[model samples]
Target: MHFDLVDLRLFIQIAESPSMTQGARKAFMSPAAASARIKNLEESLASRLLYRDSRGVELTPAGQLFLQHARVIMRQVDYMKNEFTEYGAEASGHIRIFANTTAATEFLPEILAGFLAQRPGVTVDLQERLSRDIVRGVMDGSTDIGIIAGPIKADGLQVIHFSTDQLIVITPLEHPLAQRKKIKLTETLSYPHIGLHEGTTLLRFLNEQVALSGQTLNMRIQVYSFEAMCRMVEAGVGLAIIPESSARRHQQTMGLKIIELDEPWRVRERSILVRDLEALPAVIRALISIFLTHDSARERRS
Candidate 1:
């Protein structure tokens, strides 16, 4: 009935990664050893932790509960280590972030690069997720920070507003939709649309909208990035809906036309969600400040 930090950490890693083997690699252990350790841990706790399948693994109800506490325990351990080494070492810690598609793809890459450049000891694990899922991740302590957009409620969490951007439609210059300055979601659903990949947040949101209108989106192709989506649109594959920031950037070089979305939900505020910002580690707070600073610079320019 006894387990140590290694067992806890291994379980957490397996729970986060795509496969036990991948998690083992991150933990600097062999897959066989990792499997054995997990088995022993389950036996000691008298409960199953993961559901295994060909696709990789999923957390069982018990496993999800375990992960919640495991993350909190690991964070506290990190805090203790940092306090002990305050005099001898520079600020150092790992920050786990969950962000919606717009923030993750449009904004974070350059911003994170600058943050990392200045803080050599800090590392980040970033994932793109739906806004609701990001809220859940923050509530469960599984994520250190979440950058979410849209009308998702963060009732109990501390929210910090950052950037405001809208979803804009892009089409080939010769496309019929390009002749208009603005278009509605309903107008675009009938046309062949270039979508982001299957599991992306924006695609899911678009699907929900199409469902409400009693029609289906004609998703001709799915690409992995904003640039790819724009490229497909430029090639006359289909229309695309992307963040204004990304659309503007790609439109400058591609033969794509930007059309404003005539929907209220099109404009969304991107914000930071955290359980308690001040309770976070110093390294994490510094990164948050960087986001705020970047937003301020954008504000001044606008």
Candidate 2:
């Protein structure tokens, strides 16, 4: 029962992408060919791999099991290629990262710039995902490292402190609650709000708060960037719950009010999650070491 690594790679792509067809397209193959390759793989293994529906493809239990092995095989192949090219290439390998919207938007750019500057030969492939999904990607071996906002249950994961962030309400200076120093999130629910695009980590967290308090949020506008959301709030469109770090940056420029949230969950702590610290690739370890050093320096300065 032999299968092509290309097919395995295609299957991994399909498992990660929105659909089987998109995965095929990514592999530079047609949809029919992708399906046939997956079918052959399943037939060879004598197990169903994916569950397809209107939404998209999801890994079945068997598929999840298969992914673990496939990732190991792929990593081994990558390692061999890099080893062979070590003399020709100074330092080069791909690092896959899964980070939530907060880490992706807030502090990653600065940290990543520093990392890449020092390791010019390394390339990074980063994808933004919800915190929980980020954990899943790390646990499933889809990504080498994951930066998640706030605390989450990532069973079988090695967790370490990455950073601290928080969600705060941003309002026009003249808004009703602008005078208040701090307020419960539920108190602001009645007012029309400006929210980030759906599916973002901050937006999802806010929605969960709304759901828990049994209050509906009047989200007037959904914008892409934190700065855009602040601009909308400044225009008297509505208020928004945004990261304090971002909001603080726009405070003077946008003339917006940053109101601390009364809820304990408002202050978020970011953590790095990995499957096995010892097993991390050398490049990944180097990257993590730099981040840790930076965080320590900030701590000392603060």
Candidate 3:
């Protein structure tokens, strides 16, 4: 049977709220108008779609079955609009992305600059959050894409290897370890170490490495943001083992000395995550291509 989009929309709204009055408010129609529309829909389908009671309204079996099909139809309708809306240079859209502090502060600026240069009409909304939050945002559809450090196990998300980064031990310029090219992981335990919170990906990696070696890291301070960690290290509060990208960014400002870790736990892979690659918008796909290609070139150089 043929149904207008408006009828389907009203049906979904009624199914969602159940109360005709509440559904009318949501659909921005008067109660009488909304009721008339719903009655017309039921008449057209020749089915009892809702059962009214003293408390509110409930969907009949026919309504429940119709709601499922209505949802799919609405989704397809939305997809069609989005597909055509972002079609060309004149067609504009917004992309929302989530990233951890290191990637947000270090990596995304250049990429965004290039993207905006190419697509001036498009807008990007970036949220800087912890790795776990970034992953959650991607899974929940709150963000279009996420850039994070490894060891996340999220089902249905496509994880692409974008870049590999090393962790560096940083101290104030005049600190004892400054003179050393590389310091043993064991040596760090002797000194106060400023670290990210236990929940962060970096801290999780560090803890795993320490546990694997049958040792534990001695954390002097636990902070949420990398900028805070760098500031603390520069103030001589303690040395910190932070992502190399973060250390590179703050090296000049903090006058921090960065030394490589001696053994196995130094390197890490950074990844880009998307809920579904095939479902991503063209703008996001373009950004992903740029990120992967740029990182590949950098890898070839190294």
Candidate 4:
């Protein structure tokens, strides 16, 4: 009987966090109290909610179903709040968006700012996540829109063409590979490389491709941001493979060379994904229109 929005919020936190105790801390509840509340919630709903394992917890089938409804309820609650606030001030609503590092690093910021500038009423909450996680967020109704690198599986969502980003190799001006117009990845296997962190999509792709080809990529240093990797490359530490957009910016002033990667995977075809394009809020739909139109124009010009 004590279950309410607080319980739902805690439940979502628990689902996302590594452990229930961590979720409890995030929700500002004692672990024992959080456990008791979840038990009460399960009993009230007449179903088991979570499967506990040594590593962490996972949702049961019923928990997964409940999570979808919970996210919708929470999003609607936020919308209602934003609605009243906007009604009082005649402002646009907030939209939640997720994207991969490629989009977040090289694409979304300036375009989102321009779009928001044109429509002062709308506010946005953008987050960087892996493509698969972004897809999951859209499918679960937790995110309004997602931009991701494609040729991906998106089972119950609408996908729209965004942009195709070419990948390039970045190297210091003195590096041997810098002089090459286009070079195969295998040609660089002998040199030390600057790599992105382990879980990043591009890094994983590079690792998988190298492993598949029976080549070992010697990662001398790993960095979290493309900018940092570029800086390291400029310092003559090692070379990196990054999106052309990222490499071009660094090339302008960093004295770095951008070599076009001569591989089929050099092109990262990206797309915008949504759970229900027609059901999007008016402001969000308008924002999407602006973004996609601009991107398409750029693509055409290129």
Number of the top candidate by TM-score? 2
- Worst window of 10 by summed lDDT in candidate 3: 83-92
Quote the lDDT for 85 in model 4. Answer: 62
Which runs in model 2 stand beyond 4 Å of their true positions?
A: 1-60, 87-90, 300-302
For candidate 2, list the clashing residue pairs, or say none: none
TM-score for candidate 1, residues paired by index: 0.80
Model 4 bad stretches (over 4 Å): 1-46, 50-58, 80-90, 116-123, 297-302
lDDT against the true structure, per candidate, is: 0.87, 0.84, 0.79, 0.84
Residues 221-242 of candidate 3 have per-residue lDDT tens digits of 9997778998998899999988
1-302 per-residue lDDT for model 2 (tens digits): 88978977898889879998899989999999899999899999999999988888999999989988788678767755754555333256678899988778767789989778876678899899988889888887778899987878998899988678778888899999999999998899889999878889888888887899888889888988888998999999999998887898888688898899989898888788888877766777777887788878876886
Cα lDDT of model 1 by residue, 171-245, tens digit:
999998889998889999879999999888899988998899899999899988999999999999999999998
lDDT score of residue 58 within candidate 4: 90
TM-scores, all models, native as reference: 0.80, 0.81, 0.65, 0.79
Q: Higher TM-score: candidate 1 or 3?
A: 1
Estimate candidate 4's alpha-carbon lDDT, on a 0 to 1 scale.
0.84
